[model samples]
Target chain A: MKNTIETSDRPVTITIPEPEYPLHTLSVLVNNKPGVLARIAQVFSRRGYNIESLVVSPAAEMDFSRMTIGARGEESGLDQIKAQCNKLIDVISCYDHTDDAVVSKELALVKISVGASSRGEALQIAEHFGCKTLDLAPESLVFMVTGDSGKLDAMVGMMQKFGIVELVRTGKVVMTRGNGLT
Target chain B: MNAEPRDGAQTLLKCLEAGGIEVMFGYSGGAALPIFDALETAGTKIKFVLARHEQGATHMADGYARATGKPACVLVTSGPGAGNTITGIMTAHMDSVPMVIISGQQVTWMLGKDAFQEADIFGITMPIVKHSYLVKDAADIPRVTKEAIYLATSGRPGPVLIDMPKNISQGPCDAPLDAEIDLPGYNPEKAYEIDSKDVEAVAAALAKSERPLILAGHGAMLAHAGPELKELAETARIPVCNTLLGKGIFDETHELALGMLGMHGTAYANKAVCEADLIFNIGSRFDDRIIGQPDKFGKNATIIHVDIDPSEMGKMIQPDLKIVGDAKVVLAELNKHIKALPTESWLATLDGYKKRFPLSYKIQGGLKMQHVLDVWDRLTESNSIVATDVGQHQMWSAQFNKSKAPWNWISSGGAGTMGFGFPAAIGAQLGRPDDVVIAVVGDGGFQMTLCELATAVLQKLPLKILVLNNHFLGMVRQWQELFFDNRTSGVDLEGNPDFVKLAEAYGAKGFQIKRPADIEKVLTRALEYTDGPCLINCEVVKEDNVFPMIPAGAALEDMITEKPKHRMEKPTGST
Candidate 1:
């Protein structure tokens, strides 16, 4: 409903700019039940918040599950989403780890296409990056790497120089530092 | 000997009985045959109201909930029946009315196979409902039933859903009579600890402020805080203005009442709001329509917002001091320590505004919607339950009719659903059988759910339906004429059916009034007819528009008053 008035009677108003959005990781503790993960996904999709990366696993207790989700949205919009999620019965709690000091890890499996000459250098680089060798074929060397998201990115960047043939990375999983609960 | 296994339908009834749902509005279907069969044989004390359409059933349930401060249950079949109630569900959700909606689903094994009459109702209504569940087992019936009622009626009440698969309902289970729902995260009574310091701060603000006004909203009504609100307002000597949904919370006939404030609000109320020094917004979200320009809104005042929803605190208009608590509790606590203020000149100034800029409309040729409402209010003694459809008529009803009781004025405040008035009036009539229930609708909106006319006719409800027939979608036409360079779009309702004949065809009495001379007499006669539902086709001036409008983004003070073409003498004995 536009309120613009003509005939030199009303003053024109300025329209505000769109809000700023940033990527955030939230660790949500929820009841471990059927379709609980789907419910959380539905909540995010309903609010138009796309999940960049997600990892779900059983929490410290067997009856509950913890999900680490990376998403991007305006601060106010995210705040509203959090409030709405907080209202759900199965959701025990949700915490944003982006602003907190938390330990996080991701796993990546890479198969590097290696010539007989480059095999030695690839193994050296993998060892330097703390990667474990899963298999060694005639033309390719498979390595398993586990670290934080940034470390995985750097490891993949190093492997890109050796003509990486294939790669797959699990999304980040996180735990709060100290005695804080997520 | 072992006890015989009770079917799912019987268990469903037992759970509903446990929830204390005395009445339900629904239309049976193939998926819900088991439920109907159980009701037929069991002879449960619960009364079932057979509505013509599922949408009508939902609205009726919404009306029942709003009028009685209790959650009303609704039942519908799968797919279309469930989908039809979305508008009504959204309407109730937006307005914060408590309701429990039960829809039948396909057999449990056939859920994802896209079997006959399956539409994934639980998934479809996810965003709209307060909470929803797809009942997987019959053993969870009692627990789900209790949780549904609890979630729907507690803390900032809203609608909840339970999608029951036919197999679950027809299967056998022996659930406990009192099922304990273990919900660690679902605490409905999330009370806010109101600080004594904050109350003192508010009292201090009010004590020194020269032009303080109280903006009471629907939350006050929901909280049953009318008495406390009146006590607070009178104790502080602050003038009160209601939001559209907040109607009847403060007695409209009271001296301090400034009617309603917002778009198409009374000129005086908007003026008072614009000029006030301390604006206390109780239980209002300060929606866009209310605050024309957020930056400029309440510019002269320190806005103090008291509401239960913390999300609503700083959402729109930022409050200098926010009290997060129920309306009644907060008002009661404030009243304990508040001292009366001396604002004689402020009240006098508001009175002056009210007298100078009274809600006015000049009559042209045919009858006016405002006049019809004025007459209806007068004849009904301003005490009837009034439900209004959206558009020019809704605004006119809100402006002209003075609601004398709480929850008496029910309308689609946030969603503005068109066909809401008729079924809502029927629900209100059933809720308050002794009171006169009237549905004020425009011709454009009246035709939306007029099929419910059969429900009213067959049930023999004593409802008064007033159709303000203007032969056009008057509100959109007015906007087109003013804002869209006077180029009217698809707003003309040329081949509209004869509403009087339509009502008669549905076995209800119908009256037609086309002139000013017949307006009052015909309306009084229609109101006096108490046999069954009556429809009054009021062919009013086709171009009449609601005035005192705060143009979309303009400040409250920039209200545009009507410039009628010709002025006629004021009618004698008019309200």
Candidate 2:
């Protein structure tokens, strides 16, 4: 099995082994001031941790921004990152969302070319996976999908049989479920 | 509500008066000229303590804050002045000293356009300060000043920067100067509330423990929790071992007082920590120097940590239980439920360790550093506030000079900044005018900020400076001799300036002591010279090293007390 970018479609095959470096998702609240994001990023860069994925948006508060960061590192390294992040002045709070105590989602838009022969199969796959038809052209169709990052990846793989054209993905956003961490 | 309009400088002076800032340490520059003029003209009653360098001013503010437990304001000009304050701010940040630093910036119109003497001080000090504000409006002075003082002096106290633009200080405003603070995101007091459950848990642990030890840190001093801590220790009959910054927080002369515990700590203190059945770490971060090997530190103990900052918990060693609150509040609460427990047998065992491994040095040498410190300690008695620079002399001072009162021992413990002693001593003297303030610095560290001598002379501060002239960076030289095959690289000060002559040039009385016989006489004279600052240059054996040192990453039990070549047989202890 190969894990590579899906090119030329044909249901690109992929396999992922057990991760030695576990994935950690962290939700950080920070002041919505200039240079804060760069400061937060530098903290990770200085500590030698690569951010796997990041999504930042204004939080419920007027002057605060919430950032969701997904990174892969050893458990101890991840803990160190959390501790260092907490030390930053702009950072109001940093909560680790790796546990199942939170709800998370990632959005992806996949544009795939659908010939008449594969049109039926493509529509059937989209319908089965609950992917929304964002735009439908005679030859190519764009479907917007929202789910956990893994589920979105699976959807992208299944849609690859129709000859994928262009794909864009928004990382992930997370929040604790049911009146948890405020 | 109709207050007269005033310029930015007058407004800032008014705010300073409102904040109850009696004195501020600073050096004036172009950007700060308006504020200085206002200070002179407005008669706001905020006395200015001038410093030779901006760095010296910052250290003065830091020492003042550390000594008084109040926020000391620092005023400096743009780029160079702000840049010079980095070391002082970092030192304050590391030790949680309360300071408010006001750096003058280029006018708001000239910002980001490469104006002369302009600096992005707010951005530069973001990591070093607890908080910072870039004030563009003169009307914001009262509010910003109030916030800065509050943040600097509140829970987990640290330095805060306020970048006041030149235009802001020159502008006029009629805004009512109300010192009301309204920071929604900043809440330092919530998490630090005393929890009854944690107190009960701590009380229960103390009751069951056979050998419980209390490890105190800087927070205890910052919180003024010494009396409460002493009460708790006496009630529970727990022996207290202090981190370097926590030295004066407990009475060092007390029988239960195990001296400082760290790399250069006393052997008995570290041994007690290692052998304790339960450890109560109060307000200490468990710095790497203190806990050389985290896993091996207190291997037999169930550690319980109490601190104001929640982030510090489980940072070095995972404690069996943790509590987040100010040391004073938490200790006061815990003491209410604590009854005097029987710790006689356990304390007796530690007493044996203390008696067996007392911190000692060879007295036959020519002007040994220890003897100088012993003489200084005897001459000064317990009434003196001793501030030391980072090096062998610092450890020696900590070992020899017994601090009898809280906030009496000041040193750059967390950042370990060299050259912090002289300026800090000046600040301490200014802060506590009635007390004797002595700075015991190594020759190497003394040279780092020796220019502050002029500031001391000019201010007519009665600061006593003792330069332990070892002619080398003794700590580094010792480490080189032990670990680096005796390869002395940059540690030697070959042709250092004559500190006595140098002090004389700075308008200070200079005293030189070479023979061990003259240590007392010179120290006495220097102490007697209350007219202005005095510098005592004591020439001593150059190769002397601090002892009971836990080699980096080595367990506290593995201390090197003597020269490696002629070391005594190792004593076996429980690991």
Candidate 3:
């Protein structure tokens, strides 16, 4: 089948650079039922949009669940994915909060192997970044931090200077301040 | 409600009756035995057509949906039976046909445990189904059934699945039969609400453009927008062309009709599309074959697209003006607002193209596929439902078998699945028992699902089957000749069965046409047979290549209207 046409004739018309497309955040509200999350996740991957991070929790009511997903892809694809997800019988609504006037927060637990002298500096950095000291082992300290994704990235960057042992983070839960329902 | 405790299977039947499914196709198995048993004592309004294969049953359901414009039903067991329906389900999904597939599942406890005859069918068919449900409790059966039927038939209709577990079906439940559909997120009917502003804008665009044309698709046919389409074309004086699925949307004999447009479409239609100043795409997704060069296609025209599906808008050629609504409502509104536009000279130009480069072929050497279709269409009077298999014969039928009615042209577009024609034709015949139904299959594709002949013959379906025996997979062979230096590999049908004998073996009459003179005699005799299924094995010329081809990805202007002079030599001892 490939030999049927010249190379120039193929319909490879559009080539947009991937780096130009930034990460897009979406808040999807769906029915709190079995396999709803999997269906929502499959819609994104089917359209080639990978979910960087996803947060699922009960919504304003118990019957529905709010899924805050960090999705990255081209803008058009994100728009299409939002429409596709909305078409699902389980999904009530989906909004890309990447550009919305809203507030978001994520919780991360970072454990770093610190020496006895550097422990004080690490504690100082954690306190400056609004981190809570969750635990302290003989040679390591676990810091619980909460902030927006950007702030958490900056905090993680600062902590990376130390010998970071392990890390776990929740999805970025978001809410509009005034009246917008995501 | 009966108030007496009806079992889960009986509850499902009552829900199906509520949803207005008159008939269904299926094959019974262990997981499906409960439903089958319930049908024996109940289901007074439902009729079941037993198929030899699950895949055949699915295609049969698909054909019923395509022909009747109503949602059709299919029932199959779990595991292999459920797995076999993926192709047919995907076929309906791609073409946007309305269908509901019921696959009997393993007991609730055995699910996901790799139990006997268990497959994660709900997971396997997620991408293909418009919506799916795994019945956990027997109480949810009524809701799932109502929702599945409603979803399958609404808006951009497609297949919906219900994975009914064996335990769920056999268990007793006290659920109400009139379970109100509780879908908060699903609102398919809203797409049918048309805004007058869009109609005005389209009318204004039509009034301004000097050269405008209409490109129809299967969506238009599904929407039953034929009368409105004809009204709009006549009112706006726009020349109309169609996709393969859009065959009978407009009467082919009408002056405004430019047959079909795209790859293997008529040369005049392709040229008209490339040369038009404004192109109104109604109910048609701009498939790749239609738009030859994405960059070059419609570069000169203001493309206007109206469809029910919003995802289709930006997936291909982005129209300058996009309207999301049902085709009938949109076209009807446009017809109400618009008067005739000045396309006199433009029509004359298209007329010139049609006269100069018509859909033509030479049948001098031997009996050709084109001539076979020509005679069939003439004898059938172009009013019957014509289902075609994939390959050279399919394209030739698209070019020659012009349709005269709506929902009469059934083929597996987009998926282009072979072996779809025979079963689909049987389904169409059953759906429209009075209307003439025919399946023009190739030798390569007919053998794919010939086992379904038993299903058709046992029920006494009056199907006219035309087996175009070209002795090779002619489409790939043509490609190999043109592009692969004529090194045809796995295309020969050396072990092909005698189709006449095979049809007779299945208790159907069979005939043969070996020469040009035998075409009419055999077709007429075959068409006159009303006993049951009939077949005609016409041995056609083996090397004929369909013309007016826009080589994959080539610009529409670069279409090859006729065979090139330098061609590979014909294989010896052929034709």
Which 10-residue span in candidate 1 chain B carries the lowest summed lDDT? B566-575
Reference-based TM-score of each model: 0.92, 0.92, 0.95
**Could you give the CAPRI-style class of model 3?**
medium
lDDT tens digits by residue: candidate 2, B210-293: 999999998888778998999999888999999988988998889999989988898889889888999999989999889988
Q: Which candidate achieves the best TM-score against the true structure? A: 3
lDDT tens readout by residue for model 3, B114-228: 9999999999998888989999999888888999999998888899999999999999978998788888888778777888898899989988999999999988987889999
Query: Which has the higher DockQ value, candidate number 1 or candidate number 3?
Result: 3
Best DockQ among the predictions, by candidate number: 3
Off by over 4 Å in 2: A6-20, A35-49, A77-94, A110-143, A158-167, B566-575
Scored against the true structure, residue B536 in model 3 reaches a CA lDDT of 92
Report the candidate with higher lDDT, 1 versus 3: 3
Model 2 chain A: which ten-residue window has the lowest total lDDT? A9-18
lDDT of 2 by residue, A14-43 (tens): 344455577788999998977678777867
Of the pair 1 and 2, which is ahead by TM-score? 1
- Model 1 is docked with a DockQ of 0.37
Total backbone clashes of model 1?
A: 1
- For every candidate structure, what is the RMSD over all alpha carbons to the true structure, in angstroms? 8.4, 3.7, 7.0
Q: Which docking class does model 1 fall in?
A: acceptable
